[model samples]
Target: MLSKQLTTCLAVGVGILGLGFARSNVAVAQEKVTLVERFDAANPYRVELKVRLSGRLAVAFEKGKPPEVLPFSGSSTLVYDEKVLPADEPRTAKAIRVYRETEFARTIDGKEQKADIRPAVRRMVVLRSERGKKVPFSPDGPLTWSEIDLIRTDLFSLALVTGLLPAKPVSPGDKWNASPNAVGDLTDFDPIEEGGLVVEFLSVVTLNNKKYAKLQISGTVKGVTDDGPSRQQLSGTAYFDLEANRLTYLNLKGVHELLGPDGKTTGRVDGTFVMTRGPASRGDGLTPTDLQGIALSPTPENSLLLYDNPDFGVKFLHPRRWRVGTVQGKQLTIEESGGGGILLTAESNSTLPTPEQYLTESRAYLAKQKWTVNGSDQPRRISDTPDRVDRFAIDAEVDKQHVQMEYAVVAQAVGGATIAARLPWAEREELRKDVDRIIKSLQIIKRIEK
Candidate 1:
């Protein structure tokens, strides 16, 4: 989901010092170097960061290595104004302000310096009416063509956080393409006119033995299309972690498109994102409640659920849906449409198996239940590797419900768990089509700290 809360900070700074000591007893030779000269030698540092998002943006910075945690903080604001000119009426304008904040530590000569820098009331963009007095602009209509172009430009550059601080220079159409499928047709799209872009550097910080650069940016839209003339605004900040080799944070806010005829506003999108630098750790011993911050509950309509919990190693999705009715809890009473149903339960005792082993055991277990196997065969591997997909099939009777099931089991290596979702017999025809979507949406959220 696009984040509603827009809070992010990026800071980058450098410090240099030179010291010389003379021998006490005899004449000594010493070289003198100024701090400014040392600082100038380290002036420009290369920075590259990638920010990923599932719900919120995860900022990962690359500075030739993993980023160091830097102490930092700051704030910034961007103001946008739109002026509408009517041939017969007086000129009128409206304005709005977008705010941001950042904080971090600065690194200098093997030492860290604490700093806070905030940029306030920076003008991002100014929109002007195209028709002037000749055409009457409606104050409450859809945005003009110019306005849409303006908003698009802002969205394109707002990912660079430092551009919003001190107003850095930006070339027109300087764009970074996300994944081709993710960004889709939006490739090569530009929001502002050529040569109208600007960027700002806000703050610098050092953390965890790493350095970071914070930046902010803005730009105006030039009349490129014949559709009409309009104005736009774009602003945001980015944190480049020099040590960790990743982008740690990024926040962007801007009018995506113009709404009304007077170019007031049609729609808007603003959000902030934070990302870790490397692969996430596996929490094998943690409980679901510990990791997810909430207990799992079952409902009557879909009471029973099954999931692979990497932390607990073994657990049921909805235990309440299956009540122990026999010795050793082998027999379970499940609520059914007719009244109730009985089913046997068993669990694996060894560490979670690979996808192949898990699927093989599940099939064998189903066979032991005496369920009729209408058809059984191994399916093609879903992944590029041959050992990734393990398939199984079962056609049987569970109470009155005639069940046909099949599944392709795959292990989430990074998540440190194996996952299996049963495919209903009726939906088997379309199972292959929908399976990828389900797999893509699977997530392992980190447990929140208490």
Candidate 2:
């Protein structure tokens, strides 16, 4: 996980009588920045959130239930307690974690309603590193259920999309993923396992001497049971400050439709959401590594690189020297020829699992397959709670090739799905240095597992 802790506008112009000419700052273009993603723990930002639903709600009503298409609008103010977690690895960049609290309020048909949500999900999540492209951490500590949903929902987010930014400075007409999860969540017309959205960089414009990134937002969301929308299409604009490395405001509008078995629209929703940040409340800046306490740097010597699966919400970094071998299904081979290597496999699904539960079931499955477990260890935790780790201690040969192996099976609880990563015996010691790094990198991306 990238380390935690830390971390819009509009204008109108009108030309009046032909007798007078006037200049407006709204016409001036804004300048770009060197680092717009930086955020400190003390200076948290506030968000003014709003969502409105209009248009007709297609429904079949037998009697008097009033008009189905009742216009609805809701708004809220949220504060994000953001902090940067410290990391010691050269290859692994530290990331920002955000804790959100919503002072929510809304209205429907001119009637104000309470904005009540399960408090469990309103937890802290680690944003991706701005220095590089890495999946942002959701509930960076011990992952939680509601928190996972919050991350997937990206409620009141800057549409930061968990650090899915342009490879370099971008100009008008350049495009990038709205959010890192977009490529997966909104693909091939699949059911949305969890709701999420993505933004694409459309262009840049200057308004009132301020720079703004004109982008498009789109995505797909299917519920975990595959019972949600069969298809989702979205689009929006984000006023991004290139110089400030921040998103001033975001406006998204889209329609997610649930199709009947016949693939016809059964339940459809048309909505709009906007997030605008208020003036920042400053505090002490970043905590230097010396004061990091338990959070220290990872050894950089022969460090492994993080390999993230954009779609499956799985990631692990292998040793730098390992070569890719056989690639089948969710299993893979990280090796240096026939000598010594590690065979690993990972899969994601809808069910939630405690580390202990996963270990128990996995052991049973392996035994049913005739694989003998010479030994095993009790499940342990690194960050605690839903982020527990399950270990499958091994001392036997089990592969089709019957290769003698001594490895471990580790599992970490993530949102929407459980990722099971298996390690074969061969390269256990050879690449042991990368074990911690790989294990820590195991997480579900922002996309839902469908």
lDDT of each: 0.31, 0.46
**Which candidate number would show the highest lDDT if scored against the true structure?**
2
For every model in order, what is the number of clashing pairs?
A: 78, 26
Candidate 1 lDDT, 1-450, residue by residue in tens: 112111112222111101211223112113211111011111111112222211111122675553333322222222221111112223422111121222334332235444322232111122222221111111222222222332332222212222222222222223322222111112122233332444444434444344445444444333322223333344544544434433445443433332334555322223232221211122221223322432112123222223333342322332232232333332222232222332322223234355556557767776887665555555546664422434454455544456555454443332223443334455545543333333333333322111
Candidate 1, residue 48: the lDDT equals: 20
Off by over 4 Å in 2: 1-48, 54-77, 86-152, 155-164, 176-208, 216-227, 282-450
Report the alpha-carbon TM-score of model 2 versus the true structure. 0.41
The clash number for model 2 is 26
- Model 2 per-residue lDDT tens digits across residues 1-450: 111111124331111111222344223223432224555444455544555554333343556553244444444444554444544444333444333455445555567766433343233333333332333232213332222333433442332433445546665455554443333422223323555554455545554455556555666655422343356667666666655566666566777565655667665557766665533443222234423443223334323344555654455555545554666665666564435565665544344465667677767876898887666666555555455444444444465533333234343444433333344455555445455555555565544333
